[model samples]
Target chain A: MTVEKLYDAAGFKTISKGDGKKEVKAIFCCDMLSIAMSKAPASGCWITVVSNMNTLAVATLTDVSCVVIAGGVAVGEDMKAKAETEGIALFTCEEPAFETALIVHDLMNA
Target chain B: MSEVKLSYTISGDDFTRAGEASGDVKSKLKVLGVAPDIVRKVSIALYEGEINMVIHAHGGTIDVTISEKEITMVLADHGPGIENVELAMQAGYSTASENVRALGFGAGMGLPNMKKYSDDMNIETRIGEGTTVTMKVFLQ
Candidate 1:
């Protein structure tokens, strides 16, 4: 599945940039649990972590495509720079974590 | 490939560098060319152990051994020994102070998550003494 497919299912109104047709097969959406669960994505997981700099660390380790911050999750500038430098996608949404998880589920399953 | 082993000291006082050990291990696993899933499993388990050491143990040391067939990790902390390992293993059960929680930790998910990710685990601690955790993740 492409990032656009996930965005549409997640009801994400805005996209960061340069996400044309990148593909992902799995998704893990949550906060702090990114420490353990995020890294355990089946394969091709585009994790959605709503934490701060820590999420950046998980993205680097798990080789995620994009990290969608659910419900307008926010992070500091350092985290943003780390994500950019690591070449990981960072996005946000207005829906809550659970809702975002559902959307991610449908997208990955579809 | 040559039975790589790395060790690091985790400082509880410095929340800024909590994940440093995990980061190093992650990169090491990457260099070893481990499968992404295996690397992730090792890194997450070790990362949780690192956080637990930083939070509960005041500070601790982690030793990681990686080979062609397996990854082994040992986290030793002299902070405060857990009184009840069973209760502590429960999800949502955390002894983290409010201060630690404020730093986005102490969620009570550390040990459980570690056990969930690792193929084998052993935790030994004495109340008021210290704690040592050993976990192993096998490569397929």
Candidate 2:
């Protein structure tokens, strides 16, 4: 599915509309950057509670289609700017990472 | 015989810029027509090394050379050297502080992941002196 479609279906708040047309093929949930770095699939939607600059870096490195910041984590202004500059689709939601993953999973499978 | 060489100075004080070097290398490799998997592996390995330099060492320098046959990365740091290379190589081993963990790193997977991605990995360290890591990813 496309990032825009996921945003609409999941009802998550958008932070950066980077490559809204980008296709997402998988769902990965992880907060540990190292694991996420080595394991996150290309073009996957990442669900994580960690909101930091490093998150964007990892997203870029892993080539994730989008990053869904869950658990009500507060994203830094610098991170938001970096996400925009790097063309990384970013979304934020009050739901915990697991709940967000569930929603993404259902949408992806449906 | 033709190759592209890149170097960067990693700053220990800036947690936000840890991956800049790896990201640059990733882009360069992509432009160079390297395979997707090889590019990812090289980026991941170099990124882990960059993070380690920021967290463990005060800072360091990374030199990358991309050639037709392989990509070589040499990371050197002047911070307090690793106490035990063997233990550090174990998965789930990390000496990073709690502050570093809050940033979503310090899980002790940096070195191991570096090794996992590179075709050949070597570490040379001295107590109270520094450490140097050399890694290569072959292009096929």
Off by over 4 Å in 1: A1-22, A34-49, A98-110, B102-104
Give the clash count for each candidate. 0, 0
**Candidate lDDT values, in order:** 0.73, 0.92
Residue pairs with colliding backbones in model 1 are: none
TM-score of chain A of each: 0.67, 0.94
| TM-score, every prediction | 0.77, 0.97
Q: Each candidate's iRMS in angstroms?
A: 2.7, 0.5
Chain A agreement with the truth for model 2, given as TM-score = 0.94
Q: In CAPRI terms, where does candidate 1 land?
A: acceptable
lDDT value, residue B64 of candidate 1: 90
Minimum summed lDDT over a 10-residue window in model 1 chain A is located at A34-43
Give per-residue CA lDDT, model 1, range A1-110, as digits (tens).
66666545545743343353667666665455434344435334443434566666665566566677776666567766766665566667677767776776776676
